[model samples]
Target: MPIKSIKKARKLIREKRKCVNASQWFCQISLAFFLAAILTNQLAYAFFDIAFLGELSTALQQAKVVWNVLMYFIPGLLMILAATALVMAGINGVVAFCYKQQLASLKRGEG
Candidate 1:
């Protein structure tokens, strides 16, 4: 019985670690996407300042238009994705904390 209890505690500890790792990864992904979105937004504004409206070739002007749309649109999409990852990370963090508390109680033989 003691061996089985020890095994169960170890399993819980492993699960807790996995949850922590997953939460960390999700947070990192969220931060990266957020930074990328900010960068793209800044780039879009920088390109918007180009003063070659009347001097550029038709193809170049068309390319600029496409670039503007993509830059604007991509930031909004990425922000949404970042929010989702952040939410997932929060959930995982909560679960990991809960597991930690459970493990503590189990260790005290009061679980």
Candidate 2:
């Protein structure tokens, strides 16, 4: 009930809000990178396939096949990263919401 305790609680809530904002920004950046990597890999495979078919050299054909196989793996990696980011964002949101609710209860003298 003291003034100092209330001030400290407000300060802690403000810090938590800042952390939540930072986490949101990080999640957005990570998602952007995941999408970009997927798109780039797809485009690379398409272009390489066309180029390889046009030349038809033995070595080039083999390399193209290998590259295509590698491209297939990229989506799996992207999905994993995307899933991780989603979970992290969800957890951060829950924590932020709980903290906000606590602050509200404190204001109501219900803590």
Candidate 3:
């Protein structure tokens, strides 16, 4: 009801909004990186296929066998990395939100 309380409420709201916005931005950036990694990997595989196919030979067949083995494991490794990043981002966002809520409550002398 008082001016001081009004000012405190406004400040708390601003801080909470900033935290939420930051979390949203972080999520967007993480998703962009995930998509970029997937697309680039696909593009690399396509390029390798095109180049190797154009110059097919006995030696090339042996090389392809080794390359395919590497490629088979690369996707799994990329997926693990991506999953870790996603989990970290989600945890960060949740922590930020919790902190923001606590700040708001503290400003109101409720906690």
Best by TM-score: 1
Query: TM-score per candidate, in order?
Result: 0.81, 0.74, 0.56
Ordered by TM-score, highest first, the candidates read 1, 2, 3
Sort the candidates on lDDT, descending order. Answer: 1, 2, 3
Give the Å shift of residue 105 in candidate 3: 3.9
lDDT of each: 0.88, 0.77, 0.70
Compute the lDDT for candidate 2: 0.77
Candidate 3 per-residue lDDT, tens place, 33-102, comes to 6686687678769967786867679988898888777665666566666666667667767776776776
- How close to the true structure is residue 40 of candidate 1, measured as C-alpha lDDT? 88
- Candidate 3: give the clashing pairs: none
Residues 1-111, candidate 1: write the lDDT tens digits: 388778888988999999999999999999999999999898777767764346778888888889877877999999998999999999999999998998888888886
Candidate 2: minimum summed lDDT over ten consecutive residues — where? 47-56
Clashing pairs in 1: none
Model 2 lDDT tens row, 1-111: 679669967876996797699679769966876896689687877877676665568887788778787676776677677777777787788878888877887777777
Q: Model 1: runs farther than 4 Å from truth?
A: 51-69
lDDT, candidate 1, at 51: 46
The candidate with the higher TM-score, 1 or 2, is 1
